[model samples]
Target: MQKKAGVGFYVFLVIFVFVIMFPFLWILLSSVKPLSELFGDQAFTWFTSNPTIQSYISVFTIRPFHLYLWNSLVVATVTTVYTVFVAAFAAYAIARLRFRGKAIILGVVLSVSMFPQIATISPIYIFLRNIGLTNSHLGLIIPYTTFALPLSIWLLVTFFRKIPFDLEESAKMDGASMMQTYFRIILPLAVPGIFTTAILVFIAAWNEFLFALVINTAEDYKTVPVGIGMFQGQYTIPWGEISAATVIVTIPLVIMVLLFQRRIVSGLTSGAVKE
Candidate 1:
C-alpha cells in the first residue's frame, strides 16, 4: 500500500515537472530557429528547419549585449552584497542584542515591505537624480539594496531568532566580544538564511525592469532585460535573438539557485517550523 502511494507521488511529480518546464523548453528550442522559418505558422516541435547561432551573435554585435551583461552583473552583485551585509548586522541586532522596541522596529521594517514598489518610484527617482546617480549603475544598486534590505533583514532576523541563545551566552562568557561572536559563530550558523536572502535580492535586482527603464538612459547602463527590450527596432522585434538572449541570461541564475537549493530551502523552512 505504501509503495503504491510512493509510485503515485512520483507520477504526479513527473507530470508537474513537465507542465512547469514545457514553456521554457519551447522558448529554448524556438530561440535557435531562423527568424524566417519561425514566422510561418507550423506545428510546434522541438526541431527547427534552420537552427543557427546568428541570433546569439547579433545580440553582441548589433547591440552591446556584453556591456549590458556587465552592467547587470555589477549592479546585481553590488546590491546583493550590500543588502546581505546590512541585513546581517541588523538581523543580529534585532535577534540577539538587548534593545528597546525591537518588535516595533522590526514590525515597521516588515510593514514597509508590504508597500508597493511603484509607490516609491517618484521619491527614488528624485533622490537619485539629486545625487547625480541617475543613468548610473549606482542608481540601480542603491534602490535595489533599499528594496531588498528590509526583506533580507526580516528573513535573517526570523531565522536568527529561532536559534537558541545559549551559543551566544557561551561565547560571551568565554570573553569573546559581541561583534566577534556574531561575526565568527552566529553568522556561520545563519549561512542558509544569508544565502536565501541573497537569492531573493539577486533575483529582484536581476529582473527589475520598470526601475531600470526609468532610471537608465544609456545603452551601457541598461540591464539585460531592458537591453533586450531595445532589440525591438522601429520596424521589428528580433524574437529569435531575444529568445536566445533570454535563455542565455537565465542560465546563470538558474544554475546558482539549483546549486544552493538545499541551503535556500533549509533557510526558508527553518524558522517557520521552529524545530
Candidate 2:
C-alpha cells in the first residue's frame, strides 16, 4: 500500500510539474522568436523551426536594461541584508527572552503582516515624502525592509524555538556573554533559516512594482519590473523583447532556489514541525 501510494504521488507530481512549466516554456520559446513571428497569430507553431536572439539585443539597444539590472541588484541586496539582520535579532529576543507584552507584540506583527500593502500605499507615500525619502532608493529600501521584516522575524522565531535553550545556558556558563551566545552558537545553527529569509526578501523586493513605481521616478533608479513595464505603451507592447526580459529576470531566482532547495526545505520543515 505504501509503495502504491508513493508511485501515485510521483505521477501526480510529474503532471503538476508539467502543468506549471509549460507556460514558462512557451514564453521562453517566444522570446527568442522574431518580432514579426511573435506578433503573428501562428507564433506558437514557429517555436520549433527558428529561434532568434535579436529581441534580447534590441531591449539593451533600445532601452536602459543595464541600469535597471544594477538598480534591482542593489535594492534587493540591501533589503535582504537589512531584513536578515533586523529579523534575526528581533526573532532571537522574542524567542529567547521573557518580557512584558511579548504576546501582544507578536500579535501586532501578525496583524501588520495580514494588512494589505495596497491599502496603506497612500499613507506610506505621504510619510516618505514628508521625510524627504520620496524618489530615493532609501525610501523604497526602508519600506520594503519594514514590510518584509515582520514575516522574516516570524519565520526566524519559529526556527529559533526549535533550538535548545540549554545551548544558550551552556554558553552563559562558559563565561560567554549574551551577545557572544547569539553571535556564536545560536547564529551558526540559524544560518539555514537566515539564508531562506534572505532569498524570500530578495525575491519580494526584486518583483515589487507598485512601491518601486510610486517612489522611484528616475530611469536610472527604476527596478527591473518597472523598467520592463515602461516598454509597454498605450497601443503596443513589445511581446518579443518583453518575453526575453521576463525570462532573464526569472533565471536568477530559479538558480538560487535550486541551489538552496535543501536548506530552504530543511529550515521551513524543521521550524514548522518542531516549533
Candidate 3:
C-alpha cells in the first residue's frame, strides 16, 4: 500500500510539471521552426523536422527587438533597485519601531496594491502626461516601483521581524545610530529577503504590459512585451518570430531564477517558523 501511494504521487507530480511546462515547451519548439513549417500542413505537428535559427535571426533584424529588450532591462533594473531600497527602510520602521496605526498603515499600503491597474491607469497616465514623463523610462519605473512597494515592504517586514531584537539592542549599546544599525546590521542580515524581493520586483516590472503599452507609445521606449505585440504585419502574423522573441526574452528570466533559486527558497521559508 505504501509503495502504491508513493508511485501515484510521483506520477501525479510528473503530470503536474508537464502541464506547467507545456506552454513554454510549445513556444520553444515553435521558435526553432521555419515559417514554412509554421504555416505548412504540419503546422500543428509537435516536432519540427526542419529546425532553423532563421526566426531567431529575424527577431533581431526585422524589428528593433534588441532596443525593446534594453528598454525593459533599464526600467526593470531601476525599478527593482529603487523599490527594494525604499521598501527596506519602510519595512524596518514597521517591523522594529513602535508607532501608532502601524497595522493601519501596512493595511493601506497593501490596499494600494490591490487596486486594479486598469482602474488606476487612467489617472496615472494623466499624471505622467502632465509631468512630461510619458514615453520615458522613468514613467514606467515610477509606476513599477509604486506597485512593487507593498509586496517588497511586506516581505521585508516579515524578514526583519524574524531577526532577533537583541541584535538591534546590542548595536544601540555599542553607540550605533539608527542609520548605522540599519545599514550595517539589519540590511546585511536580510540579504536573502532583499535578493528575493528584488528578483520578484524585477520580474514584475519586466513583464508589465498594460501600463507599458498605454504610457510608452514611442518605439524608443517600448519594452519586450510591447515589441512582441507589434510583431504582426499588415497581412500576416509572424508566429515564428513571435515565438522566437518569446523564447529570447524568457531565457534571461529562466536563467536568473535557476541561478538564485536556492536563495529564493531560503528567503521565502526563512521566516515561516517562529524562532
Off by over 4 Å in 3: 1-5, 265-275
- In terms of TM-score, how similar is model 3 to the real structure? 0.91
Q: Summarize candidate 1's per-residue lDDT along 1-275 as a digit string, tens digits.
A: 44546788889999999999887888888888877766766526569876888888888888799998999889988998888898888898998898899999998887887888788889999999998999898989877765788878888887788778999889999999888998888988988678888887777888888889989978889998899877775566678878888898878877987898887776567546765
TM-score of each: 0.90, 0.89, 0.91
Candidate 2 local Cα displacement, residue 55, angstroms? 0.8
Assess candidate 2 and give its lDDT. 0.82
Clash-forming residue pairs, model 2: none
Q: Please write out the lDDT profile of model 2 over residues 83-126, one tens digit for every residue.
A: 88888998999999888887998888888878787888898999
Counted clashes in each candidate structure: 0, 0, 0
Which runs in model 1 stand beyond 4 Å of their true positions? 1-9, 43-45, 267-275
Worst 10 residues of 3 by lDDT: 266-275
| Candidate number with greatest lDDT | 3
Candidate 1: pairs in clash? none
